[model samples]
Target: MEITMYDTLLQLPLFQGLCKNDFTNIIGKVKLHFRKYNADDIIVEQGAPCTQLIFLLNGEITSQATDNQHSYSLFETFGSPFVIEPYSLFGMQTNYTATYKARTNINIVTIDKLFVLNELNNYEIFRLNYLNILSNRAQVAYEKLWNSHIGNTEEKILNFLVLRSMKPEGKKILKIKMEDLASLIDETRINVSKVLNDLQEQGLVQLSRKAISIPALEKLTEKNK
Candidate 1:
């Protein structure tokens, strides 16, 4: 494998904390499914079966999540060293929650879900990491669910971003209309615009004609706290 490939593999959470030998052995034992895409190419569609664990090895990708019934949608951009919907691989859904598109020329590396269950689970560190990832997602989701109805407009907006994201710490770009956003959070359009402007003044977000960009989600979360 190329050094770049090795570095990329190690960057993913599932492969972190594994010793060098284990990493090499695991790679040698499996055939990595690799693909490349041009900007604007569709990587996967929403509701498609997530039969493998896909790693964004290079470049950037944008994902769109539409509400059930196609009422509204949320779009987010994620860079490399990322995984696409790991939690969806084995759950009752077993399908991608969003449609992902290439935002730049990108490389993808995937591991079959069967290999994940039958092979990757053999490594104790890998198992623990997977458990931690899934458990964190579930616990955060449960807590968020309980608080879904009680936050103020600002809190509701922040929770909207957090609950819809793939991870809580990355720089994320969200594409949605002002009115659509307000409807999703159960606030009026005027209220949503006011809170968004306040957030922009606080330097927590940048508003554009087409989208809202968050430089660092962690900062927004901390400021809210």
Candidate 2:
């Protein structure tokens, strides 16, 4: 589906306050690209070169991380105008740190690194905007790393789930399996199960044979606090 220039800028968080003509100019520089993927499609692999800045126009995407043998889902989902990793755009590192996949059909707009570099060289405002975006993204990455390396397993699991809860239709009933939880928490399934059982025993969650449900989200969040 073709999108108008105005609609593109409106969907972008960084371009929210810009006028219509400014959006038109930006859109002229950006090349809109569409990709349709089946469920569980890998969009970008970890350690692969990240060549463009992407703006999601439709559908859902998730990012996962892998360190050699182990893999963990970084975020349950990302939708619309969310830049993959802005830090790579300015020629820091090229490879994608996380593997991204389509949870549903995805439509994206791409601005090539060369294109961004050329534009930024001339447009001070756009350069600042891009840099600010990258700075914020880097900070988030740092925080996630700090938590994973220093925080306890239970804290990590709680933090990860709390973030997932912000997604659309995200709620207490987590359908994710023990293996996925173990991956996210960097724990073995046995240990994950034990902690989950502890949370269940405390009335924070309800774990059935198939799915786990959080009876009190507030209580689950209290662990994070």
Q: Give the lowest summed-lDDT range of ten residues in model 1.
A: 67-76
Q: For candidate 1, what is the total of clashing residue pairs?
A: 0
Task: Give the lDDT of residue 223 in candidate 1.
Answer: 84
Q: How many steric clashes does model 2 contain?
A: 0
- lDDT string for model 1 (25-141, tens) is 998877689999999999999999999999999899988887765255667778888899999998678999999999999999999988898889999999998999999989999
Best by lDDT: 1
The residue pairs that clash in candidate 2, if any, are none
Candidates in order, TM-scores: namely: 0.85, 0.67
Model 2 stretches with alpha carbons more than 4 Å out: 1-5, 69-75, 141-153, 156-193, 201-219
lDDT of 2 at 84: 75
Residue ranges of candidate 1 with Cα displaced over 4 Å: 68-70, 170-180, 201-216
